[model samples]
Target: MFGDAADAMGGMGSQEDSLVQIGVLVPLSPPGWAEAGRQLLGGLELGVREVNAAGGIELQLLVRDTAADPRKAEAAVSELAQLGVAAVVGEYHSVAARAAAARADALGLPFLCSSAVLDALTEEPTDLVARIAPAQSHSWRIYADFLLAAGHHRIAVAAQTSVYWAAGTSILRDHLAARGGTVIELNDLTPAALCDELADSRATALLLLTGTPEPAVAIVRSVRRDARLAEVLIGAPAGQPELPAWAALLGQDGAGIPFLRYLPEVFSPLGARVDAALRETMSAEPSFVAFEGYDTITALAEYLRVGSWAAVSVEGTRGQIRFTRTPGVGVWQWAWPPAQVADRDPAAPDRFRVLHTA
Candidate 1:
């Protein structure tokens, strides 16, 4: 859900209060991951309402639009710092998060990345940086394991031409090869090209590594339309299942195609509550970004309440929420959210079901 419910509380607007201020940096408009940002805002607003309803300390938010641009994200950090925020949260793009993290580090502000998953974000230990989403590399291993367990041995990869996609594909290729899986072909992602590649290769499975929803939908449509690829198992190694628009765009072509994502509702009561709240408020299914955004706010509120990020791990909707310092990204805290492999049922293409939780 979006602002229908939270707009009444002025959740994303300026609040006149002496309470603690947290900067919310998200792509709220064009060039930003707007849909994902909207979902995140829904969860964030829900977290705010829950915290306040429970008589937590008063918290005000200083919201900024990053537009998924690194330069703009960096500037937003500076502006938030100028606004005297205690910490910052929200950002779904890895590139934007990286830029914002650097600026946050320089500004001495604690930053919780809600969904960005570039591996280098945690390579160095700094007190200012932490992430609620695991690095892309971490998810790849989980996806690799899922593919192998699903009996996929001969795999072909069709990836979008981006550094992020390239990094993940490389890891997938290596991990699969180590497990005796063969990568029959690798090529740039395109609907027609992928269809031809799948037909030409002896692969039993095709891995589509892409970040955006349009291309992913196109690739899935291509596979469904091509007789040669009709029987091939399709795997989206990134967070396609987490995209709010994926199923709607994919339609019946989404049936049986497995995609990796962070699932907050797998046996978590808190996750269920958050999901239900968002659905009611936004009139849409909650995505992984929403779960992470909610958790980031919950975690930050806890930090403000207890005066220590160390003692504030909540049973996050995404997973057991705890922070540990890792060598990468120099952030003092990092959260490794649990991953899942999910798919749309052939009988009910609109319904997404979890195939495996990693």
Candidate 2:
């Protein structure tokens, strides 16, 4: 209902035989993070190209733009399942991913989630679903530790009231409170008013747990301009800074604000080569979500060949991609991808600096 479906990519020279259809779910339209969706799609398309070229299990991609709507995602899964897709993959938004995961699980379809990491992907554990990104608790705790080490004991979070943000706020608060730190929640305030609350809290750091543009961009601009908040550190553990559009919007103000990223300090050989390819394809630096999408296909191709998630193990652009039942995570998980706390260099907003790694 949001966007027309496209038979985006198909393997060559498979006219006599049917190529396995992989339904790709992503946010390619507004309300969703469209930039993230395109990056992810770039990776997935690249993976599909490479996989087909390898000449074994053929694949065709049926793409649905979720627009970050949970209902759209669930309906997409149902439609895909009926279309006889062997597997479903991709999604950048956590809420949409969760809905898609639940539907896939109920329908007994395998869903390889690319980037959403809300911790509780499904209300109950299921072998039918798996994830490629590290859980929110896993990475956000690392962000929390980075805050503490950077001498930010009193941290504040300006967030929306989503399960994802609430989970992040709780993780930071619990992890920080255990080490004599406190978290302040500044919700529903206008960006200017947010700066006032942030200034009054005397919190050394403000973690942006809100979505991009509207409140997030406005809040960053307000805090950067506020004289009282000159010393307050702006952070986005949810990774607003990872988006290129963010820098284009905020420019210099976007720099030095640390956020979570899921790339290793060193890229694997496959990672290195794919990075170059994606850069050429995208004509810019690809976000980690791209790598996640590439890996999702890499994993799914193996599953398509072997027809078992347990038998799916492959080297992806990031590292060795494998799935296992992880504790606290309700679905099969990659266990983790590499996690880092990074920020754009204030000197050159295009350049990113890796601060902490795990």
Candidate 3:
């Protein structure tokens, strides 16, 4: 009967009769953000391969590119719905995810997000939109904790003024105040002005809340070059992998700064397994974004196979993966930790690990 139902949904062959069709919408051509999107998709593909091999509800992933545009994301969601996909995943950008989630809700299809960390994603939650990564609030809280533990009482925040950064800043400020630390300075800096502001701040630590690595490197270099700010520690969200440029820019000092990452040491074993699989299958290193893709699909596929619609939760490679319905939206929670970077080697600052809450 399950097999028959699967086939009736269309495109399921005899071998695939119990398989679910999952739609993945991503920004394969996001003007300048193409590589990140490609890496995320590669992770998704590896995840699908592993799950199918392990004998679960077979999943046929239908992929579409949203080009990092909100309008394109809506169109992608429509296209996925028309293709009879049971669930939709992706649109890594927060803006794109918000646009896509609305459409997914309208169609009553499950929307799973891997990257979008804007506070708005969970603010007006619905049952149809779920996430497999920590929200921006959680990331910022963790970042604040790291700074507090490092004996830094005064800090500065520099970030883009986007929805993601705004939410992160709110969380950071709240946490910093609670720890008896004052945010002496907060600035909205362009790519160029970010350096000048950092040079002028008297804070001992700088917390950055941005998405990509390029801007982060620029900011780090600015601080490192300033004689007065040499002792100032720098940190950012850990989601940005240690790209080569970041290493070159930070050199040895980058290792001293902490980064907020979600993957906990408790989940290291699981992360290692997934990381190994990703590296083996995709010819690329597995990032937190990739882990998000893996966990979201695994949870969704399990829910489909068991036919349980009740709120389901499971441990993911990085953190907890679960679905819950809110008044206006559905929220997905992933396991994440408030962590700090312990040390940095100029050759491998990107390899910083996390120290979770005890």
Among these predictions, the greatest TM-score belongs to 2
In candidate 2, where is summed lDDT lowest over 10 consecutive residues? Answer: 1-10
Q: Per-residue CA lDDT of candidate 3, range 285-351, in tens?
A: 5555666677777777655643333455666776555555433234645434223344445456666
Candidate 1 Cα errors over 4 Å, as ranges: 1-18, 264-266, 327-329, 332-335
* Residue 65 Cα positional deviation in candidate 2, in Å, after optimal superposition: 0.6
RMSD of each: 5.9, 4.4, 4.1
Error of 1 at 191 (Å): 2.3
lDDT of 1: 0.74
Scored by lDDT, the top model is: 2
In angstroms, the error of model 3 at 71 is 2.3
Candidate 1 — worst ten consecutive residues by lDDT sum? 1-10
**Tens digit of lDDT per residue, candidate 2, span 257-290?**
9999999899988999999999999955899999
Candidate 3 overall lDDT versus native: 0.65
Clashing pairs in 2: none
